[model samples]
Target: MKSTLNSTSESATAAIFLSAVLFCFAPVCSGEESSNKRTGEDIYKQFCSSCHVAGGNTAKPSKPIAGSKVLKSIATFQEYLENPPGHMPYYKTVVNDKSMVRKLYEYCKKLKQTQGA
Candidate 1:
């Protein structure tokens, strides 16, 4: 009888510990999922709007994002973001994930199209 009680107690303790561990990580996992679900426009507005207003480069008028050759392909766009030049800051960390880079690229392309570039 004593052995049975001990085993039951141990089982309950393990179950509680597992539940607590999962609970602690649930919010982090959900937050990441929600962030990933954000659209391309959402990402652009949040991160790029200040520098590239309406798809135009406020700092460098000549090198506007609209109709830029950099947006011609995903590879080029990723490379530019990873290793930006001039006043542009490096976005390697911001666009660390491939899906995020693709989302930003698509948003920029849409901007180009809308601007008649």
Candidate 2:
């Protein structure tokens, strides 16, 4: 009888643990299901960093591309990134991972205020 009770208790605990794991991941999965936009910092890191790094400690670009006329007009950095100059491979495929672009935009906006970005 004691063994039977222990087994049932273990099963119950396992069920609760599984439920928590599913619940924790639910919001993250749902948010990413519909989008692939990268945050701004992601754009900076993935695309801009190489050139910008050589430019200086400041995140400013060599040719001032960050605040350039082209990057400014677009509501989303993703749109700009989707079709960078001919040299830049279109991320339309690499960026297929959901919400990557959206998160990248958020990260870009953060670099302005936070060094962690």
Candidate 3:
């Protein structure tokens, strides 16, 4: 009777632990979190603002994004981000998909228009 009770207690503990772990990761795994809801501006502030501030590149002043040809099209912008040159970091993981790339591209284009560049 004692061994059976201990076994049941251990099984209950394991089940609770597994449930907690799964609950913590379920949102991330299912793509039902805020990461999917972040806007282009949010992404820019989080990842790009440090270097590309207000459409200007602090690292490479001559290559400001305000009027660059990279924003000519979504393909060009996505390609450049995935395989950037100079001091730019590769954003394959952050941008990750077409929707994210499109959002960033639109934001950059808007910046260019607003900045009159």
Give per-residue CA lDDT, model 3, range 1-117, as digits (tens).
999999999999999999988887876666555566779898888788898889888888778887889999998998899889989998765668777777788888887523323
RMSD in Å for all candidates? 4.2, 6.9, 5.2
User: Cα lDDT for residue 86, model 1?
Assistant: 94
Off by over 4 Å in 2: 1-4, 20-39, 54-62, 75-79, 93-117
Top model by TM-score, which number? 1
Work out how many backbone clashes candidate 2 has.
19
User: Which of the two candidates, 2 or 3, achieves a greater TM-score against the reference?
Assistant: 3
Separately for all candidates shown, the number of backbone clashes (residues 3 or more apart, or on different chains) is: 0, 19, 0
Q: Which sequence of candidate numbers ranks them by TM-score, best first?
A: 1, 3, 2
Candidate 1: the clashing residue pairs are none
Tens-digit lDDT string for candidate 2 (1-117) = 999999999999999999988987875565653333444554556655665552223433233343344434334455667666644456664355435655654444443322322
TM-score of 3: 0.66
Please give, for residues 7-85, the per-residue lDDT of candidate 1 as tens digits. Answer: 9999999999999889878755555645577798888887888878899887777788878999989999998988899
Best by lDDT: 1
Please list the residue runs of candidate 1 whose C-alpha ends up more than 4 Å from where it truly belongs after superposition. 1-24, 27-34, 113-117
Ten contiguous residues with the weakest lDDT in model 1? 108-117
Cα lDDT, all candidates: 0.82, 0.53, 0.81
